[model samples]
Every structure is written in structure tokens, then in C-alpha cells.
Target: MTKQQIWEWFANHSKQILDFLLFLALVSMGAFVKILKQVRQGAKASWKWFLAEAIVSFFVALLVYGFFDQFMQTSTLFTYVVCAWCGSFSTIFHKRMEDLLGAIFDKLKQLISEKKSL
Candidate 1:
């Protein structure tokens, strides 16, 4: 399609597009947490974990979006911030937080190793 046609189509469907993107972002966040958990535990990432992550992400997205829609009624920046916070908060529990933080530090260590090797 032409650029103009694509632009018009996107404008018409912007809300739907934005919602889908937000859903995908939430799913990614869930998957990231699962991956971090696996990494901390020395387990491999697999499709089973991914599917579980997706399911949790779907409900989290619904709760976040529904809450904002019901109460705050859609300011763009607020929606974005709250959705991001929801993704982060949903992933982190008390015990998992320490593991996740340590995993992050390990990644940083790896980065430092690479820099030293270079």
C-alpha cells in the first residue's frame, strides 16, 4: 500500500493498534521474568514456561487496562506508565526480587568481562 493509505488506515485503527502493542509488551515482560527465573535456577527456557508467561501476562494486561479504563479514563502518558508498572510489579515477588536483581548483576558482570576481553 501507499504511505498515505497506510497512514490513514493506522489513524483509523490507532486504538486497536495501541492496545495490541500494549498487550504484547506485557507478554514480553512476563517472558522476561520467567527467563530471569530460569537463569537464576540454571534451568533452560522452554515453550512450556513461555505459554505460562503469556497466560499470566494476558490477565495482568486485562487488570491493568481495565483498572485504568474504569477509573482514570485514558490519559496517554498515564496509561503507558501504569501499564509498564503493572508489567514490572506483576513479575516481582519478594523472594524473586533478590534473584532477579542478582541475575541482573551477573549480566553486568558478563558485560564487564567482555569489555575487559576487548
Candidate 2:
């Protein structure tokens, strides 16, 4: 691509890029709470656990945020902030998301069965 084309593309995507960066910054704020606790407790811990938690939380929060945004449209930055505020509770959010999906599937199944009956 030409310089102008690249610049145009970057300009077009700058908003999304900014939101993505914001997402990373927000999700990241809680990724190291355990490490901080470890330091406070004066327990030497391997960095691998931190890395694992960061990666896991990142993906979990991403999924939770995606599902939330899919169900309800809202400001991306605000959503990220709220998700981050939930902190280590992403597993809870994950479970809620599962329940939502399951409910939707069950509703569809009921509708299909009704149609078959008709």
C-alpha cells in the first residue's frame, strides 16, 4: 500500500484502535492484583502464574464484554471500565453469559417444538 493509503487506513481505524487500547488498559488494571498481594504477603511467586492469569482474564473479559455488547449496545469505553471494575469476577460473568445463552437456546427449542406441534 502507498503511504497515503496507509495513512488513510490508519486514520479510518484510529477510533477502533483507541477503543482497543482502552480495553487493554482497563482489563489490565486488575490482572496483577494477585501479584500485588503476593508482594504484600512477602511470598515469592513465579512470574508464570501472573502471565497465566493475565492471559486468562484478558480472554475471559473479552468474551464477557463481547457477549454484553452483543446483547446491549453501549459506549465501548464505559463497557470496558465496568468490565474491569468487576475484577476477578469474570468467572461469574462467564457463568451468567452461559446461563443467558442456555436460556436463549431453550426458548428456541420450545418455539421449534411448538411449530412442530402446529
Candidate 3:
């Protein structure tokens, strides 16, 4: 692609790119917390565990971004701040959030089935 074409493409997709970066930042923050906890407990921290938590945080951040994006446009700075706040809890809460979402999905599925039977 030409320079102008590339610039235009980046301009158009900047918001998406920023959001993706914010998601990664959020995951990083969560991973940092997990590592700290390991240090506090005097346990040897593994890069593998940090990677796993980061992966989980990525999905959690995806859900958070979707929910927020539906309401308004998010500025990069604001996104960063929000991600930092959310990330603080992500390591401990992401799994619980996933379970809760699963329960909600199950309820919705059951409701749809009942409606179809009716």
C-alpha cells in the first residue's frame, strides 16, 4: 500500500488499535499483581503462570471494552485509567466473572428454550 493509503487506514482503525493496546495493558497490570502475590507468599513465580493470567485478563478486558464501547466513545487516556483500575482486581476476579457470565448465559439459554416450547 502507498504511504497515504497506510496513513488513512491507520487513521480509520486507530480507535480499534488503541483499544487492543489497552486490553494488553490491562492484562499486564493483572499479571503484575499476580507476580507480586507470589513474591509476598515467598513462592517461586513462573513466567508460565503470568502468561496464563494475562491470557485470562485479555478475555476479561475484551468483555469490559465491549460493554463500555456500547455506551460511548472511549478516549485512550481514559481507557488506560479504567484498565488500570480493572486490572487490579482481574487476577483474583476474572475467573469468578467468567463463571457468573456462564451462569447468565445458561439462564438465557433456558429462557429461550422455554419460549420455543411455548
Best-matching candidate per TM-score = 2
In terms of lDDT, the poorest run of 10 residues in model 1 is 86-95
TM-score of each: 0.50, 0.64, 0.54
State the lDDT of candidate 3 residue by residue for 1-118, as single tens digits: 9999999999999988886776676657765775686678786667887666666666666566665655666765665556555655575675786899999999999999999999
Which prediction has more favorable TM-score, 2 or 3? 2
Alpha-carbon deviation at 81 in model 1, angstroms: 3.3
- Write the number of the candidate with greater lDDT, choosing between 2 and 3: 2
Clashing pairs for predicted structure model 3, backbone only: none
Ordered from best to worst TM-score, the candidate numbers read: 2, 3, 1
lDDT of 2 by residue, 1-118 (tens): 9999999999999998888888888888866663465567676667886776567678777766886678777778677976675655554665798999999999999999999999
Per-candidate clash tally: 0, 0, 0
| lDDT of candidate 3 at residue 59, scale 0 to 100 | 60
Clashes of 1: 0
Residue 118 in model 1: shift from native, Å? 77
Candidate 2 wrongly placed segments (more than 4 Å): 38-44, 90-118
- Write one digit per residue (lDDT tens) for candidate 1, span 1-118: 9999999999999998987787667557655765576668777667886666556655665677778878879875566556655654555543586898999999999999999999
